[model samples]
Target: MKNQFFAAALIGLTAAFGAHTANAQEPQRFETEAHAIEVTTFASGLESPWGLAFLPDGAMLVTERPGRVRLVSPDGTLSEPLEGAPQTESFGQGGMLDIALDPDFADNSRVFITYAHVEGDVAGTAVWRATLQRDGTPRLVDGTQIFRMNKLSGRAQHFGSRIVFAPDKTLWFTIGDRGQGERAQDATDHAGSVLRIDRDGNAPADNPFIGTPADDLIWSIGHRNPQGAAFNPWREELWTVAHGARGGDEINIPKAGLNYGWPVISYGRHYSGGKIGEGTEKPGMEQPIYYWDPSIAPSGMEFYTGDAFPQWQGNVFVGALKFQLLVRLTLDGDKIVSEERMLEDLGERIRAVKQGPDGHLYLLTDDPDGRVLKVSPAS
Candidate 1:
């Protein structure tokens, strides 16, 4: 009887402590069109956090644009910047950008990262793959560069680097125009294109430009600065969101052997208010399935397929930097039917969005004191 009373007392003490902590970090709640929700900071103290990935054990891998990678725990604890991340340049639109776990991560512990690095006087996007060591001391081992842009320049902007793994085990990634619009139309250049390669950086045999003068890795070309990308599980297709000059931010289903029409054609005008290309349509170039006038400056994207909010299933979410809001588009089979803007009062530049393994939505705010905000159904 005495042992039972002691156990009950310990349980009560633990519960009280938990309740106090929860109250201290009280969640901010908001009502959306579909569901009322609560947003809580999941992790903090990150510097300009740009990328977020979930580990099998529920920890998170977040990469800061200032060239640091941190491991965050479920309970909001952050590990010191993991050692052995690839060297990076934090120039304009450059830095350690996106990260992804190998498809066979459970067995091999391999991982990949995209960063902006300089070679000679020119800077460009590069990919690094390594073995992630987590045996008490978290660090990367056997690090190597799997890919680098062959065509680089003095320009520092537009290092379009987002990594996505396809269903067939191949890796697909994007590179931007590096502030030069003409490069997007150059088939010989790797810039302004979606590229496909094996985990070891070898171009796949089935790549569209095998025997062509165009780079063997090129899958699609003529993109401006496609920063947001994902493999749509429901559609088995790859989609990307790219920045336009002034008014033509767009969403394109980047396909093999296709040209997306960047400098050659656009729905937007130049920043100086001049007309862009030959106008919004061209015969051979593809058009965007959806576009935004005046540009929301989208960075990260995700397709919600979770049960946390059943109402949000089949919806597409994009993080907007220009307006500091989360943009949700309801789709009727790839055709965006409507747009709903949320979190205007949060006053944070949402950088990346990830659907957590727990069926909740997570966002990385881009700031010196960045935070991982967890969004859940209020009810």
Candidate 2:
């Protein structure tokens, strides 16, 4: 009788625990779309490709993680790596990251980049804007260091480093927690937060914590190590893919002034199976729209709004570093109805997914000798 009573008690406790943690996880779905198209490799022998931006005149700009930016022509030819790219620490995960073109690139020739800098024991990330010359050289004429974080500690982890411009012309940038466990919720700290700023790198007056003592550039707080960010095609919402500790990679729809419930609530524990954050539920915290258990280590993301694949229009394409695959999420009006995995046989870690100006899909392979690949119908 005593044993039965103890078993009942344990079951009840487990049920209560699962109740709080259930919604925080997405069941693993392993279906991949059959490759109706052949995957063609464009250029190889390039260094670790982090990001790619296409130019209006048919050239391409690619950023290497080791602090070089190269111009590639439409025929997969590489131009000489640009000079005057910002010097990066190039430590373990610390180096150059995302690259983006100004929305008014035709008129302004303005380009932006994010990178990790090490100054003594302190290492943090910064964003800068420069101008591209007519002959495809990048001369950083107005190199402005826009935003930075505290508590870098030179740990060589979690730089975040993805930048995207919203429809409203505001630039949103992600900053990782820099391996600091408790700093995600620190209002005064820029670590683990997504910030919205004007083109001049100043915080907007309407920012949530603008007048407060906290960092004024903050848009949404509580991120782990976000590496993927893109604007949604349907709603134009800002969508991000963040890495979790052991499991629990998350896809978040970030909004201003919201607390994203990092460190406070996670479905994953530490790699050693210890506790993470406070608990799963706290009042007034925002929950993720979707998350992954047994994490895929999501990297770059793009919304499939192109006309090439009519069936995939409006779906979300995310790159996986750990799994070395491509993940596609089929959303039924913002609710993830199903998920699929692709490119398992390719043995390449996907770094970025982009829609070319020709409405075809382009991807960057994340490798020491990465390649630019194009996906089209096999026929």
Candidate 3:
């Protein structure tokens, strides 16, 4: 009877994933140019793990897209789902997303999370902060809503939610156009912009658009669907990876009060091979630092400043969801020197990439049976 049940489950899985069965198997040996590395499965059986954050004690917190948070130990032990997580909408591309720990997490156990929030018939992206109590059964305490997208749409695509903290401890996050392309050009709308706010969700007094048509929280405008964000310590700028319609995947450094040129100017064309907006460049809008003619569907990104891989120092790493690989970009002062693709044989959607406290590279795969993987120098 057990064998029969197992056989039935296999059939169900095959039916569900028909053409994508290649992504369900164990990861294969990865190839790299700079150094020999080993990919170890740190933890397994996570359901579509979307975000990863490391605690000072070496433990990690992972967010599952279906509205669950799990604590993972250094020794590969997965704990029970934490309680007190905010309710998520969990629709098409919506659910529990990025997880980030406060810079002073050692003093305060505060953690921040982004998720799809729904109220009645309308839905949008929302961020929340809470204190994580790790005594026995891990749970959240004093959860507070920090920010919410100004425009709510009924559609369920393009919630570009990625969070990063600046040196001043101010929080920055991205929001997609919510599938409404024209709204990205509107400064007053929060649909497609990078927002900067204080820990208490207040706009800083130094904001460029304060008292103007643009919302005071907005730092940059004209974005599509940015999924990857990181603070480059070397350049001291906020970098982002955003998705385009058909081709035009871009890497941008969002600056205050600047327009990024979305629908009005795009390197990518429509999915139907039609023109997007104007041409790729205009007089006032900014061009991307680098763009991909064929989209890779980029996700989480991080700059490598750790000592584990000296050669990789100062390089930027990004995860590719559609291409199912990890991208290493060597940069010469923001000009991309070269690009290398790694872990192409992993056959899974690389949802997030992060550097562990131990200086190792960590990754979360997006799958029904997702996994947390650690990359180290192979002995």
Candidate 4:
């Protein structure tokens, strides 16, 4: 039965792979030449802000790791915590995660959020979407539990919850392996995968593996714990950064139905100092475009197309949680020529990176006393 299921999945993957071949091409990787990167402390005395979203009025919505959401004004003043944030477990890496306004938020005022929920000492990841009210309160009138993890092992590690809306208006969400590596290979589980769904939380009919009598929300599998996710503006390809076991932190462009080769094939080792999988080179598994050897513990990612830095128009920006810095990856076609680190002096774990409405870079610090900082040219 296992063999039959695997064969059927492979067939679906191959067909989807062929359809995406024309859209697939190598990306430009540029050498990272040193430039003057000035970091400024925008706001202080915050409490572990994790997610960031911009409002049409030029203000911003920021999510706190301790289960609170706030509205930050353009003048850098923070509002009182918005009321009605869903209760979160908030232990370990679990808390309020990513936030994104609906594609038509200006008209609908719809908002989406991810968090870790606990029930009877068991914690799991969940995604919900609702509306933010005008009176500094979240109405949450249309709350929908769009997605949830399969198993609830009470593990506080690897709840990779990040959401990005594609240009096509489809939602692409990342799920962590949740410290159970073997479940990544399980077709019935949502862990360690990228799932694509419609605004209504329904699977698309044209999905690669849809109508195969299996859950069609899954777009790709074999990921460990991916926190950073974004769509490349130039090529419209989805890109992600995931934490590896020891080393081998990866930056991969996920292909539909392709196996990313997690514990089965990794450049990292077991936490207990054991071997992992059959090594890096395998026939069917996809490899990362750029991987870190010593591990950077990447969190959120964004592609720069703003006019603030003309030279960095196409550069990729990633937040480093463990390294406490921002990694700037320069692309020269399909290779990462160089990586530049910024904000090293601040000594804070960056949890998110985003492009503001005016085209400047905005960041959220992931510390207990976290703050939302803005990055721009040193004037």
User: Per-residue lDDT for 345 in model 4?
Assistant: 69
Question: For each candidate, C-alpha RMSD in Å?
Answer: 11.3, 13.1, 6.3, 11.9
Per-residue accuracy of model 1 over 241-263 as CA lDDT, tens digit each: 98888989989999899999999
Q: After superposition, how far is residue 126 of candidate 2 from its true place, in Å?
A: 0.3
| Local accuracy of candidate 3 as per-residue lDDT tens digits, 1-379 | 1233223222112112111111233434555889888787888878788999998888899998877888887777777677888888456677899999998888899999999887765678899999999887788989989898887877677888899999989899999898999999999998889899988899999887998977999999899999999999988999999999898999999988999999899999999999999989999999999998899999999999999999999999999999999999999997898999998887879999999998999999988788888888876
Clash list (residue pairs), candidate 1: none
Model 3 scores worst on lDDT over the 10 consecutive residues at 13-22
Can you rank all candidates by TM-score, best first? Answer: 1, 3, 2, 4
Query: Could you give me the TM-score of model 1 versus the true structure?
Result: 0.93
lDDT per residue for candidate 4 within 321-376, as digits (tens), equals 88998898999876789888877767878899998887778888876666667676
lDDT of the candidates, in the order given: 0.86, 0.78, 0.86, 0.77
The true-structure Cα RMSD of candidate 3 reads: 6.3
Q: After superposition, how far is residue 348 of candidate 4 from its true place, in Å?
A: 1.5
Candidate 3 clash pair list: none
Q: How many collisions between residues are there in candidate 4?
A: 13
Residue 145, candidate 4: alpha-carbon lDDT: 74
**Superposed Cα deviation of residue 235, candidate 2 (Å):** 0.9
